[model samples]
Target: MATQVNPPRGMRDFLPVEKRVRDRVLRVIRAAYEHHGFEEIETPVVEDAARLHAGLGGDNEKLAFAVMRRGLEVDDLRAAAAPLELADLGLRFDLTVPLARFIATHRSSLPPVFRAIQIAPVWRAERPQRGRYRQFMQCDIDIAGEPGITAELELLAATGDALTRLGIPDAFIRINDRRILFAALDHAGIAPELHEAALITVDKLDKIGPAGVAAELAERGVDGERLLATLEAIRAGESTGAGGTLHGFDAAALEPVRELLAANAGIRLEFDPTLVRGMGYYTGPIFEIAHPDLPFSIGGGGRYDGMVGRFLGRELPAVGISLGFERLVDLVSLPEEEAGETVALLVDKEVEPTRAIAIKRDLVAAGQTVRMQRRTKNVTALLEQLAASGATHFAFVRPGDTAATLEVKPID
Candidate 1:
């Protein structure tokens, strides 16, 4: 009996149709990131265990795919042990941490306020469910060395614009400042010391509702009155009096954010009070984008001002966002069959290599995705299979022909 081969749990193999849609999503995002002056960069999928540990915070430590080396002596340890620590140098969890390390290592070569875009895979050791995966790609854009709110706003606007251009016009970019969230917690009678617990609870507001959140808070030692106050404060309507008097930092502190949102006339922008992102590195304005039809966020990111400093020993303010490519694919209706035209190349056994190449090139140049008929079937059989596979056009090439004739037919 033969054993069946399968992809590792929580990982997936994208079929041709799925790959097309995923590629489309990536192309649109890459174009958008480049338009915003973000230079593209690549980072190693594996890093030194020490650097990975220092850059990715505590929660991620458990998820590191640690590696060990064998078959090498202490004298031969240098050569043999090089690849052994693949586990120690776990797969990157996200692009931001790697970007920070890249900038710090290449500080002299990079410009002040460096802008970069990275598209790569990240791994998480969480249980897999409907939309979540253990390994997935994240499209990220980050800017370092600018601490102003305007920088944050620009990222928000760019993110909104990218989604809008991708046909998710109804998507909302929910924005919130960590400072504002803290201020609201302080007002609710939760002491600054318990703020992290309060944030973890409040973040679940959408998932479990107010009662569930309150229960969670109570478990963390929050008093009933204080928990209710916190919920009500966050649920309070948008502030009207410049900075609404919840926290000492008046509307003036929030004006830059407010103004930026107001300027974006097309996209739906909202100041969400409960948007406490799960990551620990975020220090300033944080945000997540949601679509009316999608149950999960399509993308999110925030300011991590101290990350660069962790490596470079100097504060370099940065903010960025990532687009969930797979989630976006889920939201879009598959392309209409009629809208997609595929060309099938039917080659005779005696066809010369040069002529076959020319025919394929011509069809591809005419904006068609070409698939060469395999030797598994005769020409007639290949043609029948191509028709069944949704190919609308076909080209038959004979040996030594200067121009291959295309027998175009539309499939119903």
Candidate 2:
């Protein structure tokens, strides 16, 4: 029996065409960030297990992929208290944690206020589904050490530039603050101990309607009725709508939300008081990018003034945004690759190998993408394969024909 060849569950394998789109989109995003004065940086895919499991990751820590301690004996495995006990390192679930550590490690050499670009793949042990993967890429730009609301605004502007450059319209960002969320809890008389759990319940308000949330919260031995009523009023777009002053918001948190709405230009941003980002590290002013055509957010981030401090022992203001690469790639339709003509150089079997190499080399040097292939009897099938592999045109190299004399024809 032949062995089945496939990628591991929840992972994916991209063909040549798919990879071309992915690479092009990544370049577009990277170019946008750099144009906004953000410089790219890289970090390892793995981090210390202790750091990965810290409270900052929220629910993501449960889904992290742990790397077992090296050189573990059978005795070590048997005596372990839990699965994670045998693991010393883990694949990072998100870029923020690793970036926090990176800044802490290299802060002295970096600028006073650093704008870093991180475009990389992160791993999560998620149940495989459409637009959800165990491994995927995140395009993130973060500003650190800027304590003011400027960092949030800059992150939003940079992300908007990326989406606009990709030709996506109708995308808007919804802003909120963790402080406001807690303030709402305080106004409703919810205990501090139940705040986190209560917020988790509220986050699901969309999936399960008010009735469902009320039921669940009641089952949790709490009355969320008044909180849900206030949330419904907020969603009704009464006192707080786009580009309008917030009325019922907490007095201190009110001004920043107003600034985000009034100052946003490149994209439409609204105030979503109920927008509870899942990450536990967020301190203030959270926002998420949404499109009218999609039911879920395509990107989101917020201020985390204390994450770097987890490593540096002192909190520094940090704000960032990440575009969901896999989800957004489907919505983008870029023009076909136009940098250069992709040419397949077909040479006869009797043609000298050096001649083919010389022709391919010359074509490549002349700013054309050239792939050399031996001429086959099934020219139609060969041309089909080449075109599927991203060839735009083909040239037949005859025994006497030089590079200048070959006849070129479009594959289509």
Which candidate leads in TM-score? 2
Runs of candidate 1 exceeding 4 Å displacement: 55-58, 69-87, 234-237, 240-243, 247-259, 262-266, 333-343, 347-370, 374-392, 396-412
TM-score of each: 0.82, 0.93
Alpha-carbon RMSD to native, per candidate: 4.7, 2.6
lDDT of 2: 0.86
Identify the leading candidate in terms of lDDT.
Answer: 2
Measured with C-alpha atoms, the lDDT of residue 90 in candidate 1 is 63
In the range 1-412, model 1's lDDT, one tens digit per residue, is 8786888877899876677678777777788777877789999987667766773454675565655534435566554544434334567777787888899999999998788889888887768888888899998888888877667666766676677667788898787777667666666677888988778778888899878888888888876346556535544635553346555424343554566566753457777767889877888778788887777898998888888888899888998888887688777653443456787776777887777888788877877788876444555676676776557777665666543456656544
lDDT assessment of candidate 1: 0.73
